[model samples]
Target chain A: MKCRKLKDSLSAYISEELSERQMSRMSRHLATCSACAGELASFKRLYERIDAVPQVLPSDDFEERFWRKVKDADAGSSSVKALPLFDWTLGFKWGVSVAVAVVVMVGAYFYLHTSYGDKARGKSEIAEMADIDRYLEFYKNYEVIKKMDFLIKLEKDKSLGDNNLPENRTL
Target chain B: MRYDRDTQLMLAFKRGDKKSFDILFKRYSVLLINYIYRFLGSRHKAEELAQEVLLKIYLAKDTYRPKAKFSTWVYRIATNACLNELRRHEYHHHSVSLDASGEENPVNRKVWMDDQAFTPEQSMEKRGFEEAFKEALKTLPERQKAAFLLNRFQNASYSEVAGALSCSVASVKSLIHRATVGLKDKLKDYII
Candidate 1:
C-alpha cells in the first residue's frame, strides 16, 4: 500500500475494524513508511486522550429517581411509547394557530373594506351636518330674511310674465 | 437463553419475573448515564435522559421482543432519544477544566491519581487537551459522533453500532473514519 492509500485507513487500522488482509497490508506499509508510522502514533495519542476522559457518574439518587419514574409510569398512563408517534399534535397546534389568525384577518378585512366603512359616506355625513350648522348660523344672524335670493327671483319672474324660460332650465 | 444475557433477562421479565428487570436496570443505568453524558455533554441531561430510557425499557416489559441484544435495543432507544433532543435544541458543549481545584464538578474534581501527582502546569495542559477533544467532538455531525462514540468509547462492536444506529457496518466504518480525521484536524497542535 502506498502512503496515500494507507493514510485513509489509519483510523480504521487503529480501531482494528479493517479486514485481516487489509490490516496486514497496512502494517507492512507502516513498518516501511516512517511518515505513516508517525501519523499512526498521532492517531493513537488522540485515542488515548479520548480514552483518558474521566467517567461521569449519575447522582446518588439516580436509582431512587429511576424506580420512582417506573412506579409512576406503572401508575400513570404509558406515554413513552406514544412520544414519537404523536408528531401530529405539533402540526395540529400550528394549524389551530393559523386558523385563528386567518379568521381575525378576514374579520378585519370586512370591517375595514365594507360599505359601512366607506370614507365617502363618512365625508358626506360630515358635510351635511356642517351645512345644517351653516344655515342655523345664518338664520341666527338675519333679521327676517324669510325671503331668500332664489325665492325672490322666482317671484319677480312670475310678476314680469316671463314664461319663456331657457331650455333645460329649472326654477 | 434465547438471546444474550440482557435479552434473556428481558425475556425472563416478560414471563412475570420482575426481579430480572431489576437486574437489567442495575447493569445498564450507570452505563447509559455515562454514554448519554458524553453524547449530550451535560451530566444532568444525561441522568434525566437515561431514566427516560429506563422508563422506556420498563414499559417494554409486556411487549418485549428479542430481536437483537438487549443492550443494542436499549442503545437504539437511547440513540433515538439523544438524536431527537439534538434536533429540538442546540447543544452547547461545556468542558470543565482541571485547574479549577475549587470546582464542585465531580468530573473535574476526581481525576488520575498517582504517587507523583500532576504539577499545576501539567494539569493545565491536560485540561487544554481535554477541552480540545470535547470541542472536536462537538464539531462532528450527530450521526458521525454517535457512531464513533459507540465504537471507540462505548465498547460497541461494529455490528452492534450498526444495530443501534440502524445502519450498516460499512457506514459505521465510514463515520468513524470521518470522525477521527475531524478530530485530527482540530487537534493538530497536540498531535505530536
Candidate 2:
C-alpha cells in the first residue's frame, strides 16, 4: 500500500474495521515507511488526547429523580386504566355534541315559532266569526233593528275562493 | 455478570418490574447524561433531555425485544437523544461553552502540557493549536460528529456504528473519513 492509501486506512486500522488483507498490507507499508509511521503516531496521540477527556457523571439525585418519574408515569397510566369508561370524554366529542344540539334547537325554534303563529292567527279568526254569528242570532230574536246603529258582520264573504282566500295568505 | 445482569434487568423491566427499572437507571443514567451534556454543552438542557430519554425507555420497555445487545440499544438511544438535543440547540442559535470554574480548567492544570510549555512562545503555539482543533470540531456536521464519537470514543466498529446510526457500513466509513480529514486539517499544526 502507498502512504496515501495507508493514511486513508489509518483510522480504520486503529478501529479494526479494515479487512485482514488490507490490514496486512498497511502493516507491511508502515514497517518500511518512516513518514507513514510518523503520521500514524501523531494520529494515535491525537486520539489519546480526545479520549483523555474525563467522562462527567450525572448528579447524585439523577437516579432517584428518574425512578420518581417512572413511578409517576406508572401510577398515572394505572389510574387512567382503572377509571370507568364513562369517566372520560375527549374535547372534540364534547364540541361535536354541543354543535349538534345547537343545530337541533335552532331548527326546532324556527319550526315551532312559525307554526304556532299560524295556528294562533287561525284560532283567533274563527273566534271572531263565532262571536259575529252569536250576535246576529241574538239580534234576530227581536225582529227589528236600526240599520246604522246596530251594524253587524252577520255572514261570511263568499266572493273569494278557498284557494285564493285572503285569510290564508301569510304575507 | 454485567451482561447477564443488564439482560435480566431489562427483561424484568419489560415485565413491569419497577425495581429493575431503578437498577437500569442507576447503571446507565450517569453515562448517558454525560454523553448528552458533552454533545449539547449545556448542563440544564442535557439533564432535562436525559430525563426524557430515560422516560422514553421506561415507556418503551414492553416493545424492546432484545434483537440487539442491551448496551448497544441503550447507547443508540443515548446517541440519538444527544444528537436531537444538539440539533435543537443549533436551531436556536446557541453555542456551547464548557464553563470551567476554579480547579476545573483542565488545560491550565495539565501537568504534561505545562512541562512542555517551558517558554511563552511554546505556550502560545499550544494554545493556538488547541483552539484551532476545537474550532474544526465545532464546524463538523452532525453526522460527522456522531460517526467520530461512536467510532473513536465509544470504540464501536463500523458495522456496530451502522446498526446504531441506521446507515450502511459503507456510509459509516465515508462519515469517519470525512471527520478524520477535518480533524487532521484542524490539528495539522500540532500533529505535523
The regions of model 2 sitting more than 4 angstroms off are A84-171, B1-5, B16-19, B90-136, B188-192
Off by over 4 Å in 1: A77-171, B91-126
User: Each model's DockQ?
Assistant: 0.45, 0.29
Candidate 1 per-residue lDDT, tens place, A17-107, comes to 8899999999998889999999899889888878888877778999999888877877555464456356566668888999999999987
Which of the CAPRI classes, incorrect, acceptable, medium or high, describes model 1? acceptable
Query: Which candidate wins on lDDT?
Result: 1
For TM-score, the strongest prediction is 1
lDDT of 2 by residue, B70-110 (tens): 66677678777765555454432432221211222333221
Please give the C-alpha DockQ score of model 1: 0.45
Residue-level lDDT for B129 in candidate 2: 45
What overall lDDT, based on C-alpha atoms, would model 1 receive against the true structure? 0.75
The positional error of residue A14 in candidate 1, measured at the CA in angstroms, is 1.9
Candidate 2 chain B has its poorest 10 consecutive residues by lDDT at B95-104
For model 1, which pairs clash? none
